[model samples]
Target: MSTPDTTQHKLIVLDMAGTTVADDGLVELAFTAAAERLGEDPATMIDYVRATMGESKISVFRHLFGGDEARAQLANLAFEDAYGELVADGRIAPIPGAAEAIAELKEQGRTVVLTTGFARVTQDAILDALGWRELVELTLCPSDASGRGRPFPDMVLAAFLRTGAVDDVRRIVVAGDTSYDMLSGVRSGAGIVAGVLTGAHDEPALKEHGATHVLASVAELPALIREFPA
Candidate 1:
C-alpha cells in the first residue's frame, strides 16, 4: 500500500528561534545582557522573557519597560545588537532535523513560511547560519506583519496574505514551541495548531494556550503531516 498523502494542508507557518534554530540559551543570554545594561533585575526580567517567548522584541521591550516607547526602543536596539553579535559569532545552529524537515515538506509541495519574534536582521542571521537562505519559501518577522507577532495572529495572517496560496485560514497549519505560537494559530483560525518541545514552553503550557497537537520537535512534523488523513 502506498503512504497516505497528508499534504492537504496548504501552508505550514513555522517559528524561527527555539523552534527551527537551536536556542542554546542565546535568547535568555541576550535578554539577561540587555536587562543588566538597562538596570533591571535579570532573574525577574528573564522570567518575564520566558513567559513572552515568541513575541516580537519590541513588544517584549515595551512590556519590560512598562509601555514606555522610548525606553522600549532603546532596549529593543540593545537586545537586537546582542543577538546579532551572537549570531555573527557562530552561536546559532539549526535544531537537529529541522532543515531536513523543511526540505521534505517542500518536496511534498507544501509552502513553508517562517515567522519569528526577532526583527529582520536577527531572522536573516539565523537563516544564514543554518544555510537555509532559500530553504523556506517565505519569511516574516514582527515588522513584516501589519500588526504584531506571536500571541497575536498578525505574522501568520501576514503569511497567508503574502503567499496568496492559502485561501482559507483553516487550511493552514501553525507549529512552534511556545504558547504564543499556539495562541497565534488559534486566533488565526488555523486547521492544526501543533506545538513542538525543542524550545520555550512545555506540553501543558502549549495545551493550555490552545495547541491542538504536540510533538517532540519540527523533525516530527513531516511524518505527522504525512500520516494525517487527506
Candidate 2:
C-alpha cells in the first residue's frame, strides 16, 4: 500500500451550508417550496436535489426542468426568492464553533476560503446572518468559477487562482460536508481532503467519493489541521 501523503498545508477551502453553517434542512425546504410553486412533484424533485447536494443551483434547476433553460431559470429565481425569505425571517444560523474555527485559522495566518453552491445573493445572506462578512479571506459561488461547482474541482481551483495563496495544490486542505465537496478536492489534487458529517452526505458517502478524513463537524477542523504532518 502507498504511504499516506502528508504534505504541509497552507490553505483550507471550506464549504458553506451544511458544513460551516447550520442547514436545518432549509435548502430542502426552499427547493420543495419552489417545486410546489412550479407544480412539479415535490418528492421527486427533493430527492434529486438531495442527491446532487453541492452542485450549482442553476444546474440542479436545469436537471429538474429536463434541460429547459428558460423553465430552469424561472425555478431558480423562485428558489432564490424562497431561500431569501427564509433567511430574512431569521431561520438560518451558523454551525456551532464555525466562526471560532475560522477565526483561529485566520489568526494562524492560514488562508481560509468559503465556497458554496448557492448564488451570490444567497451566500451573502448567509454571511450576513453569521456576521462573517469579513472572517474568511474570500467567498465563492459556482458563478464565480465559470458556473461550475463542486465535484468538478472548478471552485477549488478557482480558490487557488483567486487567492494566489496556494503555491502548490498539494499544500492545500479541502474540507466540506458532501460527497461532491470531497470529489472536488480529490480532483483538484489537494493533499488533504476531509468531509464533515454535518451536511447532506454521510461518512461512507464522503469516503467513497474521496475523503481522506471525516469529522463530526467543522468544530473539529482546527485540531485536524494542527495534526497534519509538517
Candidate 3:
C-alpha cells in the first residue's frame, strides 16, 4: 500500500491586523492611548512599536518598560483595553476581499487559521466587532501558543499541530502584512511566506525579512496559493 499524499493540502496561517483586517493606524492610536493612560510618552515608544509591528503585545510592552514585568503587564492591559474600546467604536473592518480569499482557500481544501499578536481579549474583541467569530475553525493569539507570537514561530507551529491540516511544515502557507510576519513564516519553515502591502511594512522590508512572494493585498492570496506547485 502507498502512503496518502498530503502535499496538495496546505495549512494556511494568516495574520489579522494588517493582512486580513485593515488597521488604519489603530494600533498606533491605541498605543498612544495606552501610553498616556500610564503617563508614559508615546513618542518615546512609538518607533519601537512600529518596528516590531507583528510581535506579541506583551512582549512589546516588556521591552518598552525595560523588562520591568509589572510595568509591562500594566501597559499590556492598558493597550488591550484601549484597543478593545477602539474596536468597539467600529474602527476596524476586513481588508477588501479578505473574507472571499479565505473562503476560496477553504474551497481549495486548505485549512485556514487566523493568527494575531494581540492578547486573547483583544483578539476576541476584534473578531466580535467584525462578526468573524466563526470565520475560521480556529483563531490563535499569542497567549494561545505559550505566550509567544510572531517572529518566533510558536503560533504558526501551534496552528500546524492543532489543525493537523498538513503533515509537513513546507506544506504550510503563511501570509501577513509585516516583516515580522515574514520572519515568523520563515522560522516556521512554511513553504510560502507571502507578504501583503496592506499593512505596516513595505515590499523591501517584507522581502528583507524572508517573504517568498509580495502581494498587493490579502485579496491576492488565494490565487497565489493556487499557483504553487504541490
Clashes of 2: 0
Ranking of all predicted structures according to lDDT, beginning with the best and ending with the worst? 3, 2, 1
Candidate 1 residue lDDT tens string, 94-173 = 89999999899889889999999998988888888778888887999988887478789998899899887668898788
Tens digit of per-residue lDDT, candidate 2, span 106-176: 77668899999999999998889778898888999999999898788998999999888768998889999
- Measured by lDDT, the strongest candidate is 3
Model 3, runs deviating above 4 Å: 1-9
**Model 3 C-alpha lDDT per residue in residues 152-183, reported as the tens digit of each score:** 99999999999998888999999998989999
Give TM per candidate: 0.95, 0.95, 0.96
Assess the local accuracy of residue 2 in candidate 2 as a C-alpha lDDT between 0 and 100: 69
lDDT of each: 0.88, 0.88, 0.92
Weakest 10 consecutive residues of candidate 2 by summed lDDT: 1-10
lDDT value for model 3 = 0.92
Model 1, residue 195: C-alpha shift (Å)? 0.4
